[model samples]
Target: MTGALQADLPIYDVRRPVLRLRPAKAWRHFQNLMKDKENTEEVFHIFESLPWRNLRPSAERFLRSARGQALRMREPNLPAILDDHAALRQMPAGSLAHAYCDFMEREGLTAQGLVEEFDRFAKHHVQFQDQFRWYLNRMRDVHDMLHVLTGYGRDALGESCVLAFTYSQQPSPAHLFIGYMAGLNIRRQVRSDAPVLKAVTEGKRLGKACPRLCEQSITELLPLPLEEVRRKLNITPAMHYREAHRTWAEMGVDPYDLLGKKLQKAA
Candidate 1:
C-alpha cells in the first residue's frame, strides 16, 4: 500500500511523549494563565452557573477522571494522528478536501464556496511557520471524518462532548484537554438546557466506559478509503463542520492566537 493511503490507517501505541519542562518555563505558563484567570473562569463558570443543567456530577467526575487517565497514560495517539495528517497533505489537491466538500454538499451542510476557504487559507498561510495553524488545519480537516465515525453533531455541546471523548481516549495533553475544556466552556455558554447538557455528559460517560471503543469508533468512522467495519452513527459532515468552525473561531482570539506564534518563536 502507498504511504499516502496508509495515512488513514489506525495506529495503536503503548507510550507517550515526555516533556522535560524547566521549572521556569512551566512557571511562566502558569503565571500567564493566572493573569487571565478571569476570562478562563468566566467560561467555566458558565457551566457552574447554568439552570436546568443536566451535567450530572457523575459525568463531570467521569470527565475529570478521564483527564487524569490521559495525563497518567504513557503514550498518547499524537504520532498516529500526525502521521495521518502528513499523509493527507501528500494527496493531490482535489482528493481529500474534495471528498469532504462533496460529502458536505450532498448533505446540504455547506455552500459550494467552502473549498475556496481552505484553498485560500492554504495558499496564504505557510503552515510550517505556524505549527499550531497546521494543527488547527489538521483538526479541521479530519473533524468531519471523526463525526461520521462517532455520530456526534456540530453543536458546541456535541463537539465538546466528542472532544472530551477524544481527549479521554487519545490522552494528548497539549491539544485534547485544552480543546475539550474550551469546548466545554463554549457549550455551556451556547446551550445550558437539560437535554444538551445531558448529551455532553453522556458522551463523556460513554467515552470513559471504553477508551478503546471510542478510539475504534474514530478509526472506523473516518471518511477515508479504508475497508474497516462501518457502523452507522447519527453525525453528519455538515454538523461536524459547523461545530468545528464555531470552536475554531473562538480559538482565533488573543491568548490562543499565540499558539501559532509560540511555535514560530520557538522555531
Candidate 2:
C-alpha cells in the first residue's frame, strides 16, 4: 500500500516459474462475463484461471528479449505517467499522449481503472517474482493503450480483437483463448454476415508485425505523434475490424449494444 514504504524487493532465490491451466475456472468466469460485458472482474478471473503468462517458457523467452532485459534494469512506474491526464494533455497536439488522454477522457476511464479491476481478481493476491510482477502489471496497464493504438473501441467485438492482437504480441494462451472464444461467441449471437472471426484473425496478423509496446519507454512513446507512432511501430490499419463495424452499422445494429439486446431477447 502507498501508506507503507514502497520498494521493489527482490527475492534472493526466485522460484522457477511453472506452467498451469484451469479451464473450468476460466469457463466459469467467461459465463459470468457473457451475461454482462461490464464485468471486468470476470475478465481478469479468466486470465488468472489460465495463468500461463510469465511462466517457465514465457519467462525464459522474455528474459532473452532486449525489452525484458531493459525492464529488469529499470522497472519504470508507467501507470503513474499514464494516469497523469493533465500532463498527457500538455503533450503536442498529435502526440500519442494527447490521443491517449483524449480517449480516456471521452470514455470516462483511467489507467488506475484497469489496475483496480485486476486487483479485484484472486490472482492479484498471488506472490510473484518482483520483476515478473512488474512485467504483468505493465502488460495489464498498456491494454487500454493498445485499444487506442489499434483503433479498436470498447465494444464487445473490439475487446475480442484487441485481445487477439494482444495474444500475438504476448503469446499468451489465455489471451488467445479469450480472444477467439469471445469472437466466436459474438458470431453465434448475431445473425449478420460481419466476418467477426476474420476481424479477430486480422488482429492477430497485425499484432505479429507490430512492435511490442510493453518493451518501449512510456515517456519516450507518449511524446511521438500518434499516427507517426503507429507508423514507426508498424501498427497497420485494422481493415476487417472497420469492415465489421460498417457491416453492423448498415444492418442497423449498434455492435456495442448488440450482445445485450440478444441476451435480453433470449431471456
Candidate 3:
C-alpha cells in the first residue's frame, strides 16, 4: 500500500498554558500572613498614603533610562510596546476588569484571592496618557507576567517581594533600590520576614533568570501559538515573532533550536 505521510503535521503541542502553581505551604503561609488585621491595615495604609505619588517624573526618568539600556542591548523593541498600548486602547474601559473576573472564576480563585483583587484595582485605576500610555500598558502587562514567571504570587506581600527581586536584577541600581524600599515598607506592614531583602540579595548573587527563560521557554514555546492566535484574531505585525526572536538573541540569548551553534558562531 502506498502510504502518504503528512510532512507538515505538528510534532508537538506548543500552546502556552495558563499560569500553573506548584503547591507550596510557603505560599499559603504567605497568604495567611497578608490577611492578618495589622498586615491588611498596613497594606491599606500604604496604598492610601501616596508616598511615591509625586514621583511620577522620577519614575518616568527611571523608566526611560531602563528602556535606553534595553534598547542598547537590543533585547526589546518599541513596536511591541506600541502594539500593547493599542491593544489596551481597543479594549473596553472595563475589559480588563471583566477579564479578571472571568480569569478568577475559571481559575477558582476565591473573593480573597490577592492577585485577582489586585488585578481588579489595577484595571480600574491605572491611567493612560496619549504619549506614554503604550509604555505604561506594556509595563503593567509584563509586571503581572513577571510575577507568574518568577513564581511570585499576586498578594501585596508577594508582589512587593518580587519587585525587590526585579530591582536587584535590573541594570539600574537606583530603580531597584527605590522599588526595594517600597517593598520593605510593604513587608513591614505585612509583618512578614524581610524576605524581599533576601530575594534582592539572592537575585544579585544569582543574576536575572527571566531573559534566559524568555529565550528557552517563552520564545520557543509562544511563537507558533501566538502566531496562530494572531491569525485567528486578525492581528497585524506578523513580524512580531521575528522581532522578539531577534531581540532576545541580541541580548546574549540563543532562541534558535541550534543550541550551541550560535554560541560557537559568536566565538
Candidate 4:
C-alpha cells in the first residue's frame, strides 16, 4: 500500500505485455488441470500462456512507480539463501527461513527441487524480459513459501484456499478462475461443501486483511519468527483449512487424496 515500500517491488503489475498470449490455450490447459488434478505442468502453462492484457493495466501504476523500484531493491536473493540450509538454520528459530527449513525437512522437499522446476520451465517456456522474468520467477519461487505462511497444506483443499487468498491479494483473474473451478470440483465430489467454501471465503478474508506480500522484502522477513512475520503482514490463521484437515484425518481418510480420486473418476 505504501508507495515507498512498493517502488522496488518486482511484483507483476499486469500492465500491457509485448508478448502475444493465447487465453484460449490457457483456459483449455486450466480445464485439463482441473480434471486431472495432477498435471502440474499444465498449471505453469496456464499462467505462462494466459493473456493478462485485461488485468495488468490496473496494477501498472503501483508496479512501475518509483516506489516499486525501491521495494524491488529490498527484495531478497531467495534462491541463494534458501538453497543453503546452514544459512537458513542461522536465522532465528521461529523465522520464515526456519519455518521453511522445517517444512522442507518435514515434507521431504528441497529448495533446489523448486528452483530446478522453475528454471526448467523458464528455459523452455517463458520468453520475456529479464526484469519481467525476474518478477515471474520470484512469484514462482515464493509460492510454496506463501502456502506455509498462510497455513495452507499441499492438499487439494489447501491449493484452492491459497489460490483464493492470492486472488484477494492480487485480484488476478487467472487465479480467481483456478480457485473457483477447484472449489466446484471439490464441492461436487465431497459430501459436504462447507469446508471447501469456508477455505475459499477465509482465504479471501485473509487476503483482504493482509498487506500485499508481493511488495515485502523476503530477506528481511526470513529472520523474524513466523508469528512476527504474520503480524507484520496482517495474516490471520487459516482456520477453515486447519479444521477440515483435522476432521478428515479423524475420519481415517486423507481428504486431499480423496478429492483427487473423485476427480480422476469424474474425468
Candidate 5:
C-alpha cells in the first residue's frame, strides 16, 4: 500500500481501459470452483472478472523501489527458486526456507503448479510490460509462502483466512469477497461453535498491521528463522484462527474436508 498503490489512493484514479468488475461472471466462477474445488482455473478467472486498475502505475512505482530494482536487475524466476528443493534444503534448520520446503514436500505442491493453473484459465493472455508481469508474478508466487508466514494451513478455513489477509495487504475486492463468502458458507454448513467470521476478520486485521511481504525478497527472508522472519514482518500469532480450530474439533467438525462434503451435498 505504501509504494506501488500509494500513488493514487482513490479507487477511481486509474489508467486507460480500466478493468471493470463483472460480478455475475465472477459469481459463476466462484460457484464452479466451490462445486468442484479442484478447478483452480476458476480462481484465476474470478480475479480476472474483477481485474485491477492497470498495474502500469504500480509498475512505475515498483521500478523505483530498491526491491523492485534488485528484482529487475537480477531477473530471478521466483518459481524456479522455490522449486529448487535442494537449494532450499540447505537453508538452516528452523528457517523460513526450510519450513516452506517441508510444507511444499508434504503438500506435494510447487510454485510452478500455481503458474500452470493460472495459465490454464487463458484469460490472462493480455500483454503486460516486463515490470508489470514481474510484479504480478511476484504476487502469484507468494501464495504458499503466505501460508507458512501466516501460520495458516491449506485447509478450507486456512485458505479463507489467508485470502482475507491478502485482501488487507493488496486491497483486492475479489479476495475479501471470496473470504467472506467462504467463511459464511462454512459457518452455515458446519455444525459447530467455530468463530469463522471472527477468525477471517482477524486475518484481515493482522494483515493490515503487518508489513508488505511482497516488498521483501523471498531469498532474503529464507535464511532467517521463521520466528525472526515473522517478527520482522510484524506478523502475530493467529489467536482467533487457533481458537476456531479448537472449537471445530470439540464439535467434531473436520475443518479440512467439511466445506467440500457439505457443498457437494447442497449441490
Candidate 6:
C-alpha cells in the first residue's frame, strides 16, 4: 500500500515550498500513542513536524478560480469566533457551533483540552511561511468542527475516517500515513478490514463531494442551520463509524484496550 501511495506522489514545481516531512519519525510516534491516547501532545508534534504544503498551493488556485474569489470576498470575520469554542458551545441547537459542542461532549473531549495541547506544542517551536500561516491556523482550529460536520466520533476508527477524509480533500502524505497506518492497526486487532475500509471509503466519498473546507468561512457557516451548512458544503451524514462502534460494543472489545493488548503481545 505504501508502495502504491508512493507511486502516486505528486510532482510539484521546484519553486513550491518543501515541508521536509519525516514519515518514519511520525509513524513511530503514531504507534506509541495508539496504546496511550493521553499522549495527544505527541500526536500533535508528529503532525506539526510533518507539514504538508498541499493547502498553500490549493488555496492559491482556489482564490483565483471564479467561484473561489467570491468565497474569498465574502469570507466572514471568523478568526476570533473560531478561536472561542466555549462561546460556540452556547450557540443554539442546529447551528454549527452547537453541533460542534455536542460532538465534543458526546465524545468526551473539550476544546480547552485541545487548545492547551496546541499551545504546549506551539510555545516551544512553530514556524512557517507567512503565506501558509493563515490556512494552517484555520485548519488547526477547525479540526473538531470537521468531526461534527462529517459525523465522525473521536474514537480510533473515527479518527482514521476523518484522516481519510482529510487525505482525500487535502492530498497530504501526513494524513495518508496516519490514516493508513491506523487503519492497518485496527484491522489487525479486529481481524476484519471491512469496518475500517468502509469508514475510509465513506470519508473519501464525502471529501470528493465537498468543497475545500479549509477555505470556507466558519463565521458564515457557524450560525446557519446544520442541515443547510451540510447542504452548502456538500456534506452527507456518515454511518459507518456509528455502525462499527455498535459492533465493537456488542463484541465487548474496547478499541483502545485491544490496541494496547495487541501491542503488548507484539512486544
The lDDT leader among the candidates is 5
Q: What is the lDDT of residue 245 in candidate 3?
A: 38
The sequence of per-residue lDDT tens digits that candidate 3 reaches over residues 56-103 is 444345335644334223423322322243443444443333333334
lDDT of 2 at 134: 61
- In candidate 2, the residue pairs with backbone N, CA or C atoms under 3 Å apart (3 or more residues apart, or in different chains) clash, namely none
- List candidate 2 segments past 4 Å from native: 1-8, 11-19, 53-75, 259-267
TM-score of 1: 0.33
Better of 2 and 6 by lDDT: 2
Instruction: Using TM-score as the measure, name the better of candidate 1 and candidate 4.
Output: 4
Candidate 6: the clashing residue pairs are none
> Which pairs clash in model 3?
none
Could you give candidate 1's per-residue lDDT for residues 9-39 as a string of tens digits?
Answer: 2222123122232434433443454346323
Q: Report the lDDT tens digits of candidate 4 across residue range 178-219.
A: 776787777776665357777777888888887766666777
Model 4 is weakest, by summed lDDT over 10 consecutive residues, at 1-10
List where candidate 5 sits over 4 angstroms from the true fold.
Answer: 1-17, 259-267
**Evaluated with TM-score, which candidate comes out highest?**
5
Q: Report, for every candidate in turn, its global Cα lDDT versus the true structure.
A: 0.38, 0.79, 0.36, 0.70, 0.79, 0.68
How does model 4 fare in lDDT? 0.70
RMSD of each: 15.2, 3.7, 21.3, 5.6, 5.7, 8.6
Q: How would the candidate models be sorted by lDDT, starting from the highest? A: 5, 2, 4, 6, 1, 3
User: Residue by residue across 73-116, what tens digits does model 5's lDDT show?
Assistant: 45457888889989988989999999999999999999999988
**Which residue runs does candidate 6 get wrong by more than 4 Å?**
1-17, 48-50, 61-80, 83-92, 106-112, 126-131, 192-194, 254-267
lDDT digits (tens) for residues 50-130 of candidate 6: 776665667556645675445434542234455466788667777987887667666676645676777787786544333
CA error at residue 124 for candidate 6, angstroms: 3.6
